[model samples]
Target: MFMNSPVPSSIGGIKSLARQIKHATGASHAAALDSAAQTARFQNYAHAQRMLAVHVAATPLADARSDLYPLFLTFYWKDKESGERGRETLTIQLSAAWTSLITAQQLAHNRSLYDLQPMASDHLEGKHYCSGQMEAREHACAAARVFQFMDATRLRPSASYSRVYPSGNSRNCIPHSDHPSVWFDPATRRYLFVDEPYKRAIGEREEQERERWAISHLQVIAKATWRGMYNPLQQSGSQIYFISHAFSGVPVKPLVAAVDGIPLCTADHWAGESATATPRFNSPLAGQPIPKAKPVPRARMQHDDPARPPLTFHREAGLLLNKLISLCRRRAGIKTHLESVRDVLREFLMRTSAEEDVSDAEVLAIYEISNTSVKPILRPDWPQRSALEEDMRKLRGLLLQEFAFKAYGGALARHLGAAERSLGVWH
Candidate 1:
C-alpha cells in the first residue's frame, strides 16, 4: 500500500516540512517524519531519517537495531515498503522501495564511526546468514568493557567524549596491532589507551624514588657519573633501578650498541623503555664477589720519634674501616669517642703481618675480657706507659675477637705485644 499524498505537488510545503524534521535527532521526531511521508514529501522524510541516524551512530547505543527507522517506514507506507511478499526467485518487486531499503540502512549508518579493516591476517571466525555477510561484527558482542575502568581512573572525564584511534584516519580502520608500548582493549566500543599512560606515570614515580636512593647511598660514584654525563637526563642503571645485577626477564634494560668502545643506547632506549616494553641494558656479569678487600698493609714509620710515638697507617675494622682509611690519609684526624680505640686499632694493624700474614683463624681463639669497661670512652691524655700497655693488651684481645681474628697469633702477635709494653713511661 502506498502512502496517501495529502498535498497535490506542494514543493514549497515539502521544503517547510523537511526543515521541521531536520530539527529532531531522537525518536520523538519519528511521528512528524512519518506524517510527511504520507504527504508525498518522502525526500524530506528520508533526509531527516538519515540525519538522525548519523547522530545516533556517533552516540553510545543501548541497542543499535531497536530504533525508529522501521516503525516510521511502515506507519507511512505499509506493506509496499518491504518491496515484495513471497520470493521463490530473487527479483526487484518495486522500483520505488527507498522507504524500505533506506530504513534498514540505518543499521549500517548507525555504525558509521567504526570502520573495521584487516589489522593482521589473524585466523578470524565468523558466521553467515541469508540476508548478507559480516566481517568483525563478532567483536561487538564479546568486547571488553573499558569505560568503567576509565571512569574509575578519572584519567579522562567519564561523561565526556574520548578520541578513538585507527583514528578514522590512521588509514587502518581497526587499530593496526596497538600503540607499540600501549595496550589496546578490543572489546571496548572505543580502544582503551589508558593502560600504558598509567603504567608510564607509575614507572616514572618509582624511578624518581630509586634515583634519590642511589644518589644518596652510592654518594661519590653517583657524583662521578653525573660529572661524566654533563647533564643529559642523567638517569643511570644505578638511578632508575637497583636492577638485581642479574637478568630476571621483565624488560628493565635495553640492548645497546657501541662505537669506538663508547656505548650507545639500548633497544629499550630507542623503542622507549615504556611500561609495556622490555629493554636490554649493558652491565658487567655480577662482578667477582667484590674481592674481599685485600688487607691494606700499613706503611712503616720513617724515624722513631719518642715524643710523637713512631706511628703506622691504620685500617679500621668493620664496614666503616674502608671509608675511614680512605679519608684519614687525606684529611686531618677527627675525634670521636673511639679515638683511643682507633689508636689501638692502628697499633694492632701495624703489627698485624709484622712477622708472616698467617691465614689460620683457629690459631688465636679469644676468651672474653673480664674488664667490662669496653665501651669506646674518650681519654684526654695517655696514662702511665705500663697502665696503657696493660689496657692495650686487654683492648687488643677484644678487638681480635670482635674482628673475628680467630687465627691472629704467631710472631706478629708477639711483636704487637712487645711494642705496646715500651713507651715514654708517663707515670
Candidate 2:
C-alpha cells in the first residue's frame, strides 16, 4: 500500500480499510501490523492532498511568471548534530498523500511558505502569499505559531508578536526584508536560495556556496530516505527528507506523516494551532516578574520523527545481543566471568554510535572468562582442549586491530561464532 497507491479520503472509508485489513485472517501473524499500516496509509493521503491545495510562495520568475511546484510531502529529520531534528535519517513515503491528484487540485489553497515574513524585497516585490478563502485567522500573511511549529529548531523564538506581549506593536519585529530566508521552489525545480535579497546579506560567493550546500543536503537527505527509516512508534515504512535550511540558522523539513493520528508540524507547532495557543511569556508592566496565566488546554500530538533512534534493525540486534549475553552468563556459571562478559557486551554496543571501539585486552579477557567458565564442563580430554584452543582462535578474530579506532564488531556479527551460536534468533 505505497508508492502512488490509491487511498480512501473519507474517515469512514479509511477506518473501513483498516478494519478489513485487521479482519483478513489470511495474514494472521501480522494482522495488527497490517491494520496500523493501513490506517497510516489513509491519513497520509489526506495530508498530501492538503499540500497540493496549498501554495508555497517561492521566488517569482524574473520574467514576471508565476513559479510554484505541486509540493510532494515527504518526512525528514535532523541529527542532534545540526541543532535540528537534522543530521539524521530522512524519509519520503512512496504514497503521494492523495488518492487522486485531480481531487487535491480542487481543494482550497490554505498556506504559503517562506513568504510569511513582514515584507518582500524589490527582487520579489510584487510576489504575494495566499491565505486562501479563510480570512478570520489570516494576519500579516503569517502567524507566529505557524512559523515556530513549522520548524522546531529553525526560527529564533519570540521574534514574532506574542499573545503575552499583545500590547506591544509590530515595530519590535525585525523583518526578513533585510535578509530573506531561502527555500526550494518546486515550480522552477531549482534551489531558490539565490535571489537578489539573499545576495545582499551574504556576498555573491557565499550565496552560491549556500545554494551548493542546500543541493548537497537535498541529495544527502534523499539518499538516507531511500536507505529507509522505521518509525518505532508507527511501525511503518517511512523516510524523512531534510528539505530546506535557512541562512538564518532556521532548518526546515516539510513532510506529511501523522504521529498518533495527529499531523506533525515540521515547526514547533502543529497545523491549525495558533501562536496564541501558547504565547510567549508576557513581561511585567515594570521590572517585576510577570504573572503566569493558566495554560490553555489543547490536544497534544504524539510526534513520530522518522529521524529518531535506535533504528529498527539495530535495536532488534541489540535486543538479540542482550538475550545472547543473558544466556551466556546463565551457562558460564562463574559470577565474575559473567560480569566481565556483561561489560564486553555493553562496550561493544557503544560502537553503534561510531565513536568508540572494542579493545584487544577486553576481548582477550572475555575469551579467558569464557574459557574459565567452560573448562569445568569439559571431559578433560584432547577433544576438550582442542575445542578450547579453537574457541580462543575465534575470539581473536573478534578483536581486529582496526576495531581499536572505531565501533566494535558487535554481538550481531556472524563471526561472533561460538559465543552467539546457540542464541540464534532466540530473542
Q: Please, what is the whole-model Cα lDDT of each candidate in the order they appear?
A: 0.25, 0.28
The sequence of per-residue lDDT tens digits that candidate 1 reaches over residues 1-427 is 2234234123344445544655643334555555454344222344334323433575543332222221110000112444322111000111111122222212222121122211111101112111211111212211101111111111111111123222223342121121111212122222222111122333556546544432222111011111111111334322111111011111111111101111121212221111111222111222223222122222221111212111222221322332222222222232222243444444554455454453233112111122333343233245433444444444344343232212222232333333343222222
Model 2, span 146-168: residue lDDT tens = 22222222211221222111123
Tell me the TM-score of model 2: 0.18
Question: Model 2, 29: alpha-carbon shift in Å?
Answer: 33
Best by TM-score: 2
- The TM-scores of all predictions, comma-separated, are 0.14, 0.18
Global lDDT of model 2 = 0.28
RMSD of each: 30.9, 23.5
